[model samples]
Target chain A: MSNKARVPAVDGWFTMDDEPKLLASRGVETGSYFFPKNLAFSRNPAAPTEALEECTLSRRGRVWSWTTNHYKPPAPYISTDEFVPYTVVAVELVDEQMVVLGPLATSCDPSELSIGAEVELVLGRLYEDEDNEYVVWQWKVVQ
Target chain B: MAVEGRSVSDVVVLGVGMHPWGKWGRNFVEYGVAAAHAALADANVDWRDVQLVCGADTMRNGYPGYVAGATFAQALGWQGAEVSSSYAACASGATALNAARAQILAGLCDVALVVGADTTPKGFLAPNAGDRPDDPDWLRFRLLGASNPTYWGMYARRRMEMFGATPADFARVKVKNARHGVSNPNARYRKLVTEAEVAASPMVSDPLRLLEICATSDGGAALIISSLEYAKAHGVTNPVRIAALSTVTPSYPNTLIDMPNFSTDSSFGVAAPERGFRDSIAHAAYEKSGIGPQDLDLAEVYDLSTALELDWYENIGLCKEGEAEQLLNSGETTIGGRIPVNPSGGLGSFGEAVPAQAIAQVCEIAWHLRGEAGDRQVEGAKVGLTVNQGLFGHGSCVILKK
Candidate 1:
């Protein structure tokens, strides 16, 4: 097997630019990405002060929908004995009508994913498959 | 039982009709036209009298980018009353219903017709065309082999573990709905499904068998609704009016519904999520109509699978959480029972018709409230509800009255 670390079949799903990153528009946007090889990582592009702005969107949406996953994904995804459930949210960006779906922080729950709740995009770990760790994106409650 | 407080001047369902739901092997547009004509005839109005047309779209229905309204109107003879199309997964039909009602209520049009139709492929619903790797629905199927039933299976297992519901309880819902569907002339499965037959059926997903799951089929449903004043002036008295239309999104348990996606949010790390997101659709309706769940003589919920029907029971507030199985076992959810759910045989008997299913739910409620349903009538039934949740978290719950 080639020893070069891979993005794990995910780089094919998104419409990435130099950074090989998409704003999570299509296919699936919930998987977390391990950094260091964004193909084009630009820190503090627009909002220099924001912790998440350089990584993803700037305070993208008022939550469109949300959910807490108390169950782990099957093998090849999560090896934890029923890994701790996470939250998945579909946030409609403030600038666009786009709805981005992803996992919420491990601490999030159902009460946080209401119709008109406020949500912000942040970089987080989704899960891992085999050898190389699998990193992905996520949403967190602004409060 | 009186719950939601509804507007007395709400729009009335002037007409409702449906093409038989089954494997008809016809294009979706053909069914749309047929159902539209049937609705016009039932409403005692000509098709030319329709002022606005709204459509719920099927993904394969030839919309370059999913434009449903114009596609359906052109098929039905473009007399051009304002037209639009909407998509909300399974909630498309209910979304269409609400759009038509809004236009009439907003005085944009006095008479409006809403239609939803589909000629679905057999077996699992395949995702959008080809190699595009970003769709969650598509990724789930291609990667994890999580077909639709897999989602249903996870939910079924969760319900069993969390609510103490048994597989047999899920089967009872199918048995009850099939018994009711037998009376519906348009229902695909007219024969009753026995509990034993369901148990004997081959498993599609664990805890759910082939019989326990609903099939995909072709169907068309239409509704002609008008301002309450317009109905009265047209000499159409006692029309079944739409008192409330609630299209809500997945909330609490919505947290646990992760597939082809990574782990669910850790509720153990934080406070539990709210149980109100899904349940509030009907509750919101009750608040608008002043009618309680007990006041609803009948209900038509999206039973994509038998286990899902149990979920709708709690969501629609028909029974307390975990009590759905008890309610089904006691026949409280059967026809002639206290609150007959899916009296038109529901999707269990109807199969998955995509766009048309939610509208069909309202159509059935209208027939029951009007006493026009000869065999499947809910005696003294005055209030009824229709509930469904579509793709991308689009949910709906509508309340109607005679």
Candidate 2:
């Protein structure tokens, strides 16, 4: 399996302390979320960290809309060229009066996703670069 | 404001054209040419007569571009018309429209043509090649794996949680737009989508389902615009006068985490942030036209996702935040209702064509104002408005009159 891909070579960002990691920037708005400094990742690399606050409060929203990652994320996202389907869901949070983004577990399928299904947030990785798995927040139907 | 209804430049739209949006196998230039030609023909003017041309650009395709001025000029047979290209994500078309209006208003051109087209690649649109640690799109992809839909989902979830908007409410919007899409000859998924169908759509991001979301497509849209005097000299008396074209960038200290690829700005940066991004766009238009949202008979907003449409309602002052749902559900936002919105299927129905989408929204208002829209016409759509917000804080809005 061709695991490591030469994505790009660039400067990495860091916080008050820690070494910079490889990063890809666009215009400004860097190191905000996707490309946090290595300091942030080194703090808790294994799990998804909340940016502002993670309200354990459950939100009651019917599924607003959804799309399936029928094909695995393209090149830079995953290690293999193989295609895998991942359901991407958008659930309306009940009380927060806002929305959150996340990925569906790989076990989900397009046929399985329907509108108006009560859903909740799920944090996981889409794929992994050899050094670290590309992690982000996603959603799943809250059975 | 206008106590006696003072006049502005009053540019008129002569013609509008668009390439049918779908998964067409073609390059962006092809769609652009088709729409440009259609606009020229619709205007009853020859391509050679066009004095200026502007194109909206796509970043995925715009990296290291040769300004696309000559490329698009060549695509439309290279009549040597002045050309310009704009890139502002989904708002590129509107930005290009702004450039064309500016040139015409500045007396730099007689009749200007604006065109925007895009042939989107399948799957989540990602950042460009190479690692620019400072680039926000790249950082988001690297850190969050939060694809474009993630941000859309975030707003959707937030809206529901913050407000009492139900998923069923969001589905109603999809159903309404899908019905409109089915009638639109240029829309990608034109079948009438049902609320139940929207409910049944599999979850792609979270609460958002497949049917509820708008898809990326290959298409083009174009417009032919002329200063009022030019239109009158060209044996035209009545035309859709674009009273104002406003394109404003977002101010600093924006709280909303707009880019799923990146987090909200640290706010610790600069003081006296200019203004909220979306408000600035509308304010610029109002400044130019000397009119407020109260004068708008109808509007077309960027509905990249259903929830964003609600945000626009607040931004444009259609109603207060969290009140858009009440407004929509009350049928106050319908075609015959007060302050009708998205009467032309919107991005939800027509699909996004990058540079062309914004221009196309204006075309819809023009058509409605001209009393040409067959079914989705807003009644007495005089003094129409079109508003759009693009990535990187780029935004646009135009006020029009007959």
Candidate 3:
């Protein structure tokens, strides 16, 4: 694992260093949060022109909903040579009261999931190339 | 309740028509032109007399397809008619309908023709072409491998956990819709399906079987709309008039996770609206039309999945939250039920033609209102409604009365 170079599928979404967290933007005045952070504009009607501040999201949340895919999705989604079904979880951030969606940890089983179950963020590989591993933030059941 | 301080003029649906839903493997233009001609004939109006044309655009066919209004006009032998095109995912037809109604209400056009058609590709739909990472539509699939059904599955599972809805309940929706489809001549799947058959079908997404989800197909639908005064002048008395049309967007701090968005807007700063986006859509229509859910004789809704049909019942105010399953189990939503829904078999039987299905829903309502629906007619139908939601958080509702 140490020999393989790691990178995010999309840059600036999360960090890989110690105490990793999902990166996001929050309204400085309105106290609202945005994921895949809106760099161009703020959507708050109360303060339409307020400046946005970058912040890392809460590390833990609860499962709002969950489902598993039995069929491979069509492109531009990358997949493996030997296809395997995967699960997606919609997690509600405890602090923000917002729902963020992501794939569950690859090793997690769908049968174990239930609504309101505690979950935490962890970086996992989505796919890989010859030299580097493509990764994205995923949700895992808190043990 | 007529949308306080706004005096809105009424618009009438002069005629409605459709090209049968199927996998015809033909040009979408052929379907659009054929449906337009049928609508014109149904209204007893000449094509040359139309003052405006509005088309629900399709994205699959490239440039000419995106410019659907002009393409359809040229194919129908153009007469210099004014044209407009609208694209709103599944709600495209309603968007086109709203556009035409706007023109008529504004006195810009006395008569307008609206058409929507599509020859959809088989299998799951892909995002629009290009390598723009910023597009959430692309990012969802690219990073999480989240297909459309994946989202539906999440909703189904959540409902099941919250409401004690079983898989059998979901299968029952297919059984009911398929039965309705058998009576619909224009339906793609005309054979009735059993609950056992639905359960046996392979799972595409957990909790949603292949038979329980709608398929994509090629189809077309068109409507001829005019001012209420024009209908009267044409000697058509008691024509079906459009009572209200609501096209609303999600309010700020939208809590529900909708399509094309990776995360929902945070409610931390402000309180979320009491009603979700779907409820607001129906509320707006009811407010504008001065009609309530009790007044509706029947309805047609977007049923992308069997579970979704149940969701619509609650969203459209046909029932209270978490009671849609009870409404279904009571046989209250069947064709002969107290408030019949999807008598045209819905997307379950007709499959999705994207741009065309919403118009087809209105077409079904028109036929029922005129007492022309042969086998699937609702007896003494006086008021009908259609509800549809498109990607990017567009919700549309239309109410029609005879």
Per TM-score, the best of the predicted structures is 3
Instruction: Give the alpha-carbon lDDT of every model.
Output: 0.70, 0.68, 0.90
- Cα displacement (angstroms), candidate 2, residue A139, comes to 15
**Which segments of candidate 3 are over 4 A away from where they belong?**
B1-9
Candidate 2 ranges with C-alpha deviation above 4 Å: A1-72, A79-143, B1-8, B60-66, B130-134, B268-275
Instruction: Using TM-score, rank the candidates from best to worst.
Output: 3, 2, 1
What pairs collide in candidate 3?
A: none
> By DockQ, who's the top model here?
3
**Candidate 1 lDDT by residue in tens digits, B356-383:** 8898888888888888898988988888
Candidate 2: true contacts recovered, fraction: 0.11
Q: Chain A: TM-score in each candidate?
A: 0.52, 0.47, 0.95
Measured with C-alpha atoms, the lDDT of residue B274 in candidate 3 is 78
All DockQ scores = 0.05, 0.11, 0.88
Please report the TM-score between candidate 3 and the true structure.
0.97
Please give the distance, in angstroms, between residue B15's alpha carbon in candidate 2 and its true position after superposition: 1.5
Interface CA RMSD of each prediction in angstroms: 12.4, 8.6, 0.8
Ten residues in a row with the worst lDDT in model 2 chain B? Answer: B1-10
